[model samples]
Target: MVVTRFAPSPNGSLHLGHAFSAIAAHDIAQERGGRFLLRIEDIDGERSMPEKAAEFRKDLAWLGLEWEEVPAQSTRLANYEEAAQYLLHEGLLYPCTCTRKDIAARNPRMGPEGAVYPGTCKGQSLDPDKPAALRLDVDRAMAGLGELSWEDEVGGTQIADPRPFGDVVLVRKDAPASYHLAATLDDAADGVTLVTRGEDLFSSTHVHRVLQELLGLPVPTWHHHPILLDEEDEKLAKRRCSPSLADRRAAGEDGRALARQLRMGEFPAGITQSNA
Candidate 1:
């Protein structure tokens, strides 16, 4: 059976952008006569609160989005760990301990070099007892990816040469598995054959695609749809920037209203309602 999923981090409440992606994935999978699953991305221990995760699920249910039951990503680290170890054993990953400053110095064009990472420790060693993140050997993975393209139902065919990303961190220096790692593993584990997400994550597909090849897992069909922006025309965040989804829902904004607003080709406002 074909499978698809709407996996979200439990760091914040579901927002209008999230609602758009969720509806698209669920509706597409249903139309294709496939299964739609929900996986709580609770990998970030510090920010992932049980209450917040509950609010995400509650909000989705209220919006009438259904899913096949699984506990959550926090409960499923065993799967990710096993996959990471498989890659490690296959020599697909290396240990990295580069600091933010070290990475920024290497690639100025790299966005927010603080996060782009120079892969300083790709071949170096640290105290075995000291903490470190696992970095993927991207050049090797690129050689593995070769030239492959997938057509999206909504976004169109996306192509890229996966040679420049360099070795990226699979595990964060301070966190276990980063979003790309966990997400790739989650899709593989759940037998997902289709993936529909926000266009903001379009570049993220390269990272996931590499991981999928390195793990000997099948890469699913990808559809990166447009995001629903707020009045500020900015991506939604739970931080000082965007309002929380729970707050919006409590104010009585519904998904139907959001869909209509976006379909009408409305641009988000320059200034949004103040959360503070």
Candidate 2:
């Protein structure tokens, strides 16, 4: 069966960006006869507040999107740890103690996201008691991946070289799995087959693909969609809260009003009673 997800971090409220993703994933589920899941990507304990998660849930429900159940990252920590260990056991992961300054000093040129990790301490001996983040060996995976291309729902076919992402951090020193690691694991665990999110995340797919291969999971097909940008053409951050969902609901926002604002343009949507 086809399964898709809108895995949002509960670090902030649902804004225009959230609604765009919610509708995109929901519409895809409808089209594929699939389940549209809502997974909380709150791996960072410091950031995830109970009230924020509650508010995020209410906001999505108010927007006419529903899910199977709430599977939180903190509760699913064991699974992430097990996955990390498995990668370590397979020699796909290595510990690095390089600080941010060390990384930039080694490689000044950065990719789209930021400075490509220089792999300074990649092969260096480290104290067992010292803290370290688990990093995926990109070159090893790249040898298997080569040049890859994915189909985007909005932007058409895309090709990636995979050199820029370099080695991505899978697990932080504190054992909180990075978003790339946790999302791939949760998506596979939830049996997510089609991933629908903003185009801005397209670059991150290289990291996800590498981990999927390292972990022996079948990589899901990607459909990176258009982002809802602001007047300055910057990626909209929920902190602005200009056309806030809460404000909209207070002003009587419902499915139709949301659709119009989101440019989803009314094709019949609801909090449908489905397996999702």
In candidate 2, the residue pairs with backbone N, CA or C atoms under 3 Å apart (3 or more residues apart, or in different chains) clash, namely none
Model 2 error, position 75 (Å): 2.1
Measured by lDDT, the strongest candidate is 2
Candidate 1: Cα lDDT at 179 = 84
For model 1, the superposed segments whose C-alpha errors exceed 4 Å read: 111-115, 253-276
Clashes per candidate, residues 3 or more apart or on different chains = 1, 0
Residue 249 lDDT (model 2): 72
Model 2: lDDT of residue 172: 84
Evaluate residue 254 in candidate 1 and report its C-alpha lDDT on the 0 to 100 scale.
77
**Tens-digit per-residue lDDT, 42-93, candidate 1:** 7786888777767877777766777785567787778778888887877778
Displacement of the residue 145 alpha carbon in candidate 2, Å: 5.5
